[model samples]
Target: MKAVLERKSEEALNNNSSIWRNKQFLLLIWGTSVSNLTFSIFTMALPIMIYELTRSAFAMGTMRAIEFLPNLLLAVFIGVLVDRFNRKKVLLSSVGLQMVMILTIIVLLLTSQLQLWHLYVLGFILYTSAYMFGNAYHSVLPLIVDKEQLTSANSVISFLYTFVGLIGPALAGMVLLVLNNIYGLTITAFGLLVLLLFISLLKLPFIKKEEDQKKTSMIEEMKEGWYSLIENKELWNLTIMVLLSNITSAATLSVFIFFALDVMNVIETKLGIILASTAIGGLVAATVAKKMTRWFTRGQLFIWSLAIQSLGYFLLFFSLDWYWLVAGMFCNGLSGGLMNIHYFTLRQETTPNHLLGRVAGTSSMLMKLAVPFAFFGVGALAEFIPVHFIFLGSAIGTALIIVYLIRTPVVYMR
Candidate 1:
């Protein structure tokens, strides 16, 4: 027992070293911040844009469905590609594709030839590329940092994402107002500028992979990833947890815009403020997650966060006033941030470094596979059921996950 304890302590020390603080990690973080900022802007703005153009909830749902479709269709293949190639190259190439796609969309929008189909096509392409890039990014994280620091490293990433999210939506709202008065060319131009800067500033130092020279076909590589996940009990359990969490989260997101616009009657400007408030709550939660994890077991953390979010969802369901809804969103955001830190860290720590990309991809694929269906279902349900009941249902789904966790052996191992 003493020997085992000592070994664990040593591993922890090694993980906390400055050697894990490489220049590559810093560059990657900066690049991610820039890219996510732009991504968040689009995430918040596009829904509003579609609503304004069509005023149809179905249209908004379809747009979301298009964005998540790639995760369902190409996730496994993307995972295989990430594992087989130079991950850095894969990352850069995916970002480059996004840059081109965004530029094209901007041009079309500026030319005033932007049809709804154009928006759908462009959004699909961008999100597809993002899914691929995200798979590579998450997979490579374990390679960059030591195993013990996985939690800390994930916390850092989540904190950055939360920070960007906080500013991105609010900025998008302001930009929308500014661009609405202009020729619309200015918004496109500014978006192009942000994309260029993000791509240009992205610099990754070379690092050797464990399977650097191993030649494997994509099909074989994909099979290996699948085998790994299926064989690993911990990984399989974690994947299940992720899938349940994602379903609830996606449902909430699918209906959130309608709630803000139709239910709360919030205009564009105040809507931005509310978005910022939620993001700020996430940022605050992420900032303290590391400390929280020190006191709680991973299982405990997961259960508590889910419970908090479930409660928040219930509040949202009952909230009639704008301020009350915003408060509920804020609570949900905090739970989201905490969950992000825990989920990513758990995945990184449990998976082997060589299979990180494939595992990450496979796991992402599973979680996201349900997203399109969730969006469609929620959208359709909203047409029939009251929006409040949808929120209540999401909360119930989240609660079910907690109950499953309590009964399963998933928590004790990690």
Candidate 2:
């Protein structure tokens, strides 16, 4: 009993400590913001580039499949490396590889040698490297920041994400409208170059791996992560939440290009706006998340956020007009914003420092395993069913999860 109280005291002290004064944390967040900008723009631009070229929903799903395939395959190994090595080096190398790959793409575009296959290969590399970076970054946060401040820090991070979403996609749309694919890509390349500069200045606290840790077989390490996640009820439940959420979300959105272009008749040039609209709700939620989190239990926030977010689909899936679409997006973003803060912080708070990487990697790989299947399934199914019907299935899936959460201990966890 005394031990638990000491641990709580330590955690309270850590949380109340000022991370705002930490130079390293600030630099990390700033550098991450830059990298997020690069990826955000790239994410919005990549599908547009492919859809414009192929005009096939299968092609888009396949590209996404390629992206996540690498994430699924390499995530475990990346987790092992993060635990076994200096996280800063992993982050730097991953960011550098992505920059070089994006640069290669820019060159290909400028030389008129760009092709669909080229995007497939580069997208795979970009996403895989991103997962590597993410695994390392997530692991490193607790090392540098106070445990108590994680929610606040992550809320800020979520805001940056949505803020980029708000600006990046709209910018991509505007850029796509006025410029060509080459320009959209060149801008991405430039953003990555800036990321390289910021990453060079970034640093983190040192974490030592025990000699026995080095002696552990790679398979053993991977097995450890699986245990860490599956044995923990909270972790397992959160994993299930994202897994189900993503499957349905994937099914509904796998044919978004067709939905936007054919169903809504949105111009190719304005697709970015449609994509950016989702970020608006996220930004608002993020802005108030820290205060709001304090006002409610994490469980309450998660439940209510999911409810509010679910309400947006009526407008998101049904709205034909751009303005209504934006409104739906705002609702989507709000719940999304709440979901991210609690989800990530919950993992960081619970996972042991040494196991954070593997647990994150294994859980990510498992949860996202359902994503590609959903994408492909939605793509193929849309051929037979009207694209609009996909949302009906998605809404039903969400309600099922909500029902499970309400009936379980998950919603009552502090």
Instruction: Report the number of the highest-TM-score candidate.
Output: 2
lDDT of 2 by residue, 1-414 (tens): 344435544644654476566555777778777767656667777888789779999999788678767667888888988887778888888888888888887788788787899999988888888889888888877766667788877877888877875676566777778877667767777776676676678755444555544687899989988898888887788788878887876776777668878888888557766667677677777778778866798888877877775666666667768766667666777877788788889899898878899998888887888887787778999999888777767766777888878776678887
TM-score of each: 0.80, 0.83
For 179-222, candidate 1 gives per-residue lDDT tens digits of 65133324433543554455455443344454456776788888
Against the reference, the lDDT scores of all candidates come to 0.74, 0.77
Inter-residue clash pairs, candidate 2:
15-148, 282-333
Q: Model 1: C-alpha RMSD to truth?
A: 5.2
Error of 1 at 238 (Å): 2.4
